[model samples]
Target: MLLPYAKPPPGDADHALLPPRSVPARSRTGEGFYMVRLLKSALVLFIGLHALFYALQNIANIDAAHGALAYVLSGADHAAYPATMFFKTGNPLLAWAALAVVLAGELAVAFFGIKGGWDLFAARSGTAEEFHAAKRSGVIAAGLALLVWFGFFMSFGAAFFQMWQTPLGTGSMEGAFMYAMASAITMLFVSATDD
Candidate 1:
């Protein structure tokens, strides 16, 4: 009597007999969405607070009949106006540059908050598949986040220069630190995600 035996298909035996390959599963939970939301909120709040502080400071100077720009420019020339060690009347261009840099940074922050919030909400509501399909692009969100971070760093330099030249009160210092923290946290979150 002859025994009949069947040969396994090529590659099938190798793949099937061997344990199935296990890939580390990625999470698509609401936790990630929540984290991004918190970060966005903090960024917006910080920008608003900082802008308000600056506005108040400028208002105070104007009300006091002291020329804010003159005070900023003429570092040590005006005895009534405090001298800023870093800024001098000769460096008017620097002051303007700093102002422009900060304005750009605030705008970038706003853009990020809007886009990130939209993405997070869509993802959390279980519409990620639809959202991803319509968008077919993470470029906008990623670009906004990058721009915000870049602008933040640029503004940090300008703010540092301003603080060195003019006295930034405790409130300003605290706000700056908070902004820095928020930026760092947002960057970390953006970098960790696949989308």
Candidate 2:
């Protein structure tokens, strides 16, 4: 029996009898929650800034940049590797078009990744739910980078343009593979949600 204004102690059978009370679940910090957030924000921002600066610096050098593509086209002449025979027309304008496409994707990765990191950092004090919500942009940004560097540069460039033949180019198979891997790992890390 309960007295007026007197509640039974928690864990008491009397307390249990009180219509199955509801309690909001407390947020779980678990291990390294903050550290994971820090890592995510920093890595994403680094990728974004790295790509942004590289693209911005190179955008002004269109002729030189386009010329790099010309070097790849030379692989078509390689008797040891006739991959370039896949080309219907090795027009210089088409080369510039490819470069433009790459630059656009880079700009997007830069913008989305940086902005996503910023969003995560800004929501640092928010609840775990808010933090999870903030990851959407970062995920999209990282995916975009993976798609461009891995899907486009490595896949299309290697398969279509014979990018693997380059000895010193960053878009060479080796370098593109590295960039793609980095973006993929970052994307996976950023996509993690509290379990």
Candidate 3:
């Protein structure tokens, strides 16, 4: 005995169908992109602040003769050691080389951060293909920035060790270690946001 009406299987032509799943609203996507941009902006602002602080510290330490080294050496402690961690009395070339390395790292970090911000913004608004491309670019830029910062952070220990070995100063290596640790914390935050 056949029922008066029998329901067709889902795949049957007679079966009613639901509409295809819709992509998330554009507004939602835009909001996500905006949040990422906001984060990148904050990171850039932090870098600027760090740069300003470094510049101010250097300027404040300049001597009356407008000689930076003179002012630094006048101080009775780590102040006298060459910025590159070399002893002023030991080897001038080593001091210069260290300074150059530090400066180069700083410059690279600044450039990478700026480029990363732009790339992140682009990835946020772009199509899937474009987003992936931008993501790769941003990751590289960010990785370079991290590398530069880490190099300087590690150098702090060497600088402090040089200071300790030289007659330039007497202090525990705790300060240098602490600084490196703090920097690591900042790097961790930056990396976490990248994901």
Candidate 4:
């Protein structure tokens, strides 16, 4: 029932929704907004720098890196596991191929992470949409990090090569795990909506 003096409801009011003229709450615009964006960028930058340095190190010490890869691939000192696993090889060509893959992956991660961080930093003062859009590179970098550390090192090196049996391999696996987790955490953090 409607009062005689009451006005009629909106013709398009088929559902209980906010009025078209209503203003949304100020969630994205705040003092903490820039800080959040900066933090995300900084985290990604750190990851990028880490990869860059690692790649540089490997390149600078190519002989050592090659030897390490050879040691792990050959499964030479794995006394406990008498049975040999597949892909175990002492071929220099294979060692070089593995190293090349690692270097390439690391460089890719570095490139994307650095670019993403820069993009996010540049868009810090812009609209929320812009900042969100800047996260694409960061996301790609995180994926590369996972592919390199988790997929290549952990799965192929540690498991397939039985690298865990050797001291050097154990050290390498630990480092790889750390890098993987760092990238994952950064990705999750960066993906979060800024409010």
Candidate 5:
């Protein structure tokens, strides 16, 4: 059979696993790559460090922090909460457990996010293939950040703690959603392969 070009087409059986060009993920130097890399790195660090700071600050005063958490859990003066059984439980153990999970997640985000940013920075001078390969850390970091804000805070705080029922509770939800979206969008940007 005749061929369209000298080599097999990009999606053909012979080239399904190969790049059309020499380097698969490498991209030509351009403004878009730098912009995406910068934005992704900043977003990862921004959310990760912010969560770490929150966890660190709250650790010093567990009693006060749990007091606030309990307040949010109770839905404040709002009567629209699903139920109040958890509030009546009145166990510091549960609060401590929640605090521990959040703090751990925060630390993970901070560590992974920083590592991802460093990887990207170090690869800036290398080939686009190197930059693309270095993005693995950033991807993991961004995922952790999203999980911390959305999976942990939004789900646990709003569902378990009923944090979305009151002004302060709602405020927490808004912040969580914001961080989650920022991390998500940054992930999308960084995941884009450039020529």
Candidate 6:
């Protein structure tokens, strides 16, 4: 039914019933599909490197990070609302634990992103099924990115710890939102099925 006008060119009944073999599946799909695979790889790699460098920076400035967490948890300048924080703490152990969780999450995202990006890049010239299979790691990275930024920073830090009260906290929340949006968009773009 695909090529009703085209005949099997002086062939037997079995051959005549089959679709034309001249046109390839690749020709029907075009090159844009391959370009999308490449874009997915590049975007994931960018997010991976961004997270990796941020983790490194956090390690380099451990004292600063710890201090920031301490200040946020202490609820120092939360004058906007009269409601008191239910879980305010100045313990170094708690702050350190929080920082560790963040670092671990970032490192995990970096690992998955880099690995997935490389897999996708390597499968660019492969069949569509191969490229689809290569997206597993990238999808995981994107999900972790959402968990880190939206779940940890925005929901936990901002809502629970009241991190949006201070100027520094507001800046951090905004940055987290931006990163979350980027990862969400990338996830959607990379997950779309192509024919």
TM-score of each: 0.43, 0.78, 0.49, 0.84, 0.73, 0.85
How many residue pairs clash in model 6?
Answer: 0
Residue runs of model 6 more than 4 Å from their true location after superposition: 1-28
TM-score of 1: 0.43
After the best TM-score superposition of candidate 1, give how far the Cα of residue 86 lies from its true spot, in angstroms. Answer: 8.8
Q: Give the TM-score of candidate 5.
A: 0.73
Q: Give one digit per residue, the lDDT tens place, for model 4 in 121-174.
A: 888777767778989998899999999999999999988998988899999999
lDDT values for all models = 0.44, 0.74, 0.45, 0.87, 0.72, 0.86
Query: 58-109 in candidate 2: lDDT tens per residue?
Result: 6888788788776665454444465445663467887788788889988998
Q: Clashing residue pairs, candidate 6?
A: none
Q: List the lowest-lDDT window of 10 residues for candidate 6.
A: 22-31
lDDT tens digits by residue: candidate 6, 48-87: 8878988999999999998988888887788885376477
lDDT of candidate 2 vs native?
Answer: 0.74
- Please state the error at residue 91 of candidate 1 in Å: 4.5
Per-residue lDDT of candidate 3, residues 1-195 (tens digit): 954655657677444344555554335467766565556545544553453454355345533213322222233245444354343333444444544554555455455555655665655544545544544433443444445444443344334334343332222234334533544454455455433
- Number of colliding residue pairs in each model: 2, 0, 0, 0, 2, 0
Model 1: ten consecutive residues of lowest lDDT: 130-139
Candidate 1 lDDT by residue in tens digits, 134-177: 22122343344344434443243324234234453223445555
Model 3 C-alpha RMSD vs. true structure (Å) is 8.1
Top candidate (lDDT) = 4
